[model samples]
Target: MADNIYVVGHKSPDTDSVTSAITYANLKNQLGMKDVVPAAAGEINNETKYVLEYFKIAPPVVLNDATDKKVILVDHNEVGQAVDNIMKADILEIIDHHKIGDIQTGKPIFFHNEPVGATGTIIASMYELNGVAISKEMAGLMMAAILSDTVLFKSPTCTDKDKATVEKLSKICGEDPQKFGMEMLKAKSDIKSKTAKDILFGDFKKFDFSGVKAGVGQIEVMDLADLAPKREEILAEMRKALESEKLDMIVLMLTDVIKEASDLLFVGTAAAKEGFEKAFGGKVTNNSIYKEKVLSRKKQVIPPLESAFKK
Candidate 1:
C-alpha cells in the first residue's frame, strides 16, 4: 500500500476537472490523508488558468501518465477521457458527474457519481459532510468550475443543488455570481491568441458508439462573431483531426453562452451528417448549423448525436 495518492482529472482538463481535483485533494489532506497530491491530466485551458491566477493558487502539476500510481479521478470516468496508462494505475476512488463508461477497477472503490452540473457541486457537499472548512480561495475556485460547467446556470444540466451550492460558494468568496461568471467567461473568449489546433483540442473529447468514432470540441464565448474570422482555419484543422484520428466525425461547437445557442461546424461521413440532421432537425449549411437553446455539450450535443448514430 503506497502512502501517496494522486488526485487527478480527465484529459483535456476543464475548470471543473482541475478545480475538483485540487479541492478534493485538499479535503483529503485535511482529513488526515497524508501525501494526497493534486494533478491534472492535460494542460489547463485559458479559463482555468485565469481562475488559478485570480485566486493566486498554483496550478496542479500535469500528470501525463498514471503508470503505477494510486489515483483518484474527478470530473470524468471514461478511460478514453482519462490519462494515458490510466487502466494500469491503481484507481482508489472516483468522483464524477457524467455518465459512467468502460472503466473497470480491480476492486471496489469509493465511487461518487451524481447528476449535478459540475463535479465541484458534489465536492462542496463533501466538504460540508466531512466538516472541512472551505477556504476563501478554494470556494472561489469551486465557484469558477460551477459557473463554467453550468454556463452561468443557463445549461440544461444545471440542477437546484448546483444553484444553491454556487450561492453559498459565492458568499464564501465574497463575489457576485453573475459578475464573476461573466469575467471568467470573457477570459476564455480570447481565442485569437490560440492556433486552430489549440482551439480545437482545448476542450475536446472522443467518443465511440458501436465502433463509430466521434470527436467533439466545444468553446464557450460571449458571441459567435468572435469565431467567424477563424472559421476556415478551424474547419481545416477539424478535417486534419478527423483524418489523423480516423474519426467518423469531428464536430466543433461554438457555444454562445449568453444566448444559449450553438453554431456547430462539422466534417464527417454522410451517415454522421445525417445523424446531425436527425438529431437537431436543422440543415447544415456551408458545413455549419445554428441551433438555439443548445448549451450543455454533455446533455444536448452528445446524447442526441449518440442517439442519431444508433438509428
Candidate 2:
C-alpha cells in the first residue's frame, strides 16, 4: 500500500466519483494518514455542480493528471482513462467499479474493484466499517452519487448496498429518489455550446490495458437525439484520438441519461473488436457502434470486462 493515497475517480466525474473522493479523503485523514487528497479528472457536470452547491460544499479538486501524485486511483484505474496530468505514485492502490485500466506498480497494488453500481457505495461501506461519522451533507452527496450512477438502483451495476445507502441517505438529505432524479436530469439536460466532440470526450481517459492499449470516453446528457447529429463528428475525433495515441481500442459511450442505454463505440484493430465481442457478447460491426445492456460504465461495462480479463 502506498503511503500517500491520492483518491480520484473516473473521467467526466458524476456525483459518485466526486462524493466518494471527498468521503474517502476524509476517512484516510481521520485515520491519521496524511496526504490524502480527493481529485477529479473532469469538470463537474451541471447536476453534480448543483449537488455540491446545494450541500454548500466546494467541488472536488481537479486532477490535471493522475500521475502527478502517488496514485490511489478510485472509481477508475485505467492509466490512460484518468487525467493525463499524472505524477508517478510510489505506492498505488485502486478501488473502482469500472474496468481495470492498465495499472503498473513497482510493487503490488491493493486493488478492490467490483462491478457495483456506484463507487460511492463502495466507499460508503468502507466508512461504515471504519465507523466514521458522515455529515448529512456528505451523506447527501454520497447518496446522490450512488443514485445518479445506478439510476436510483435501477442500473444493472446496482447492488443491495447501493440501494440501502440511497434509501438511508434520502431520509437525511430530504430528497425523494424519484423527485431528485427528475431534477438531476433537468440539470444535465440544459447543454449549451457543447459540440458532439466536446461532449463526447471532454473527460476522456487513456490507458495501457495490460499489454493492450485502450481509451474510454463518455457523453452523458438527457437525450441521445441531441448527440445523434454530431455522431459523425464524435466518431471522427475519437478515431483520431485512438490513432494518434496508438491505442489498441477506444470505447466511446453515448449514454442516454433518460433511457439508461448507451451505444458503445469501439474503434481499433481486430483484436480490440474481438475483445469487446468476447467480453460483452454482442455483434461488432465494421465500424464502432455496439448496443450495450446498460448505460453506466460503473455498472455495466467494467464488471463484464473485468470478468472477461480474469478469464
Candidate 3:
C-alpha cells in the first residue's frame, strides 16, 4: 500500500469535480496503476449523490489533508481550491479543465489542463487515447459530469469537443443524455433541506486576485423561484462569511438553467465592490444584479473579475 496514490478534486466538490476524480482513477486502474484511489475534498453534493446512486457506485472518500501522500489532482489546479495541505503531498499528476494556477512542485509531473466544459470530458478522451475501455459505470459518471458542467450544453463554455464526448459517453452508458441530464439537474435543484450557509458554500471557491481575496460560489437550478424567498437569508450568510473568512469579497451566483441566466448576490469591501462593478457593467441593486446569459462562473465571471481586480 506504500504505492497507494489518491486521486482528488477541488474543495466543495461539484458533480464534475467528484465524477472526474472517480473516472480518472478508474482510467488509471485500467492502465495497470493498481493503487490509485479516488477521493473528494468535501462532502459530495446532492447532484453528485444522484449520479452515484444511478451508477450504483460509492462516493469517493472525503480526504481533507494529503500530507505525505502521492496524489493526482482533477477538476482544479489552484492551491486555494485544492485539498488541505496539498503542498505537502508528493504531486504525481494533474488532469484538469481550468486555468493553470499556483501549484508548484519539486519535480516536473504530468500536467494536463484543457479549456473544455468539464474535466470529465478530458478524462473520457484520455480513456480513448490510451486505448482503455471505459466501463458503463465510468461512462455514466463522465456523462453526468459533462452534462452538469455544461448545463446540458446550454452554457457558453460548452464546445464542440464537449458535445462530441457526451455523445460518445451517452452511447457507452446506454442512457439518453437529455433525459438523464434533466434528472441529475433536478437533483441539484433540490435544496429545500439545505441551510442558507449550505446553499451558499455548496459549490464555493476561493481566489486571490493580485492580493485581494474573494470567494465565488454558484448554484444552478431549473427555476429561481425556489430561491427567491431565501434570497435575504442567503445574503445574510454571505455577509457573515465575508467577515469571518476575511475575504475582500464574496459572490454567490444563483443560476437558472431554464432561463439561461444568473442573479448575483455579493458582499464586499469598497475596493472589492469597485472591482466587481468594473468586472460587469451593470447596476447593483440591493446587493444583487441580474445577468442574462451568464451561465459559467469560470469562463464568464472569474475572468472579468480577475482582470478588473488586477488593475
- Highest-scoring model, TM-score: 3
lDDT by residue (1-120, candidate 3, tens digit) is: 457899999999999999988898899898898899999999999999999999999999888788898999999999999998999999999999888899999998999999989998
TM for candidate 1 is 0.97
Model 2 C-alpha RMSD to native: 4.0
* TM-score list, all predictions: 0.97, 0.79, 0.98
Task: Summarize candidate 1's per-residue lDDT along 225-271 as a digit string, tens digits.
Answer: 88888999999999999999899998899999878899988899998
Give the poorly placed runs of model 3, Cα more than 4 Å off: 1-3
Ranking by lDDT: 3, 1, 2
**Prediction 3 TM-score vs. true:** 0.98
Model 1 lDDT at residue 31:
99
Q: Is candidate 1 or candidate 2 better by lDDT?
A: 1
lDDT of 3 at 24: 88
| Per-candidate local distance difference test | 0.91, 0.71, 0.92
In model 3, pairs of residues that clash are none
The list of candidate 2 runs beyond 4 A from truth reads 1-5, 31-35, 65-71, 83-87, 99-111, 207-212, 269-292, 298-311
Quickly count the clashes in candidate 3: 0
RMSD of every candidate to native, in Å, equals 1.4, 4.0, 0.9
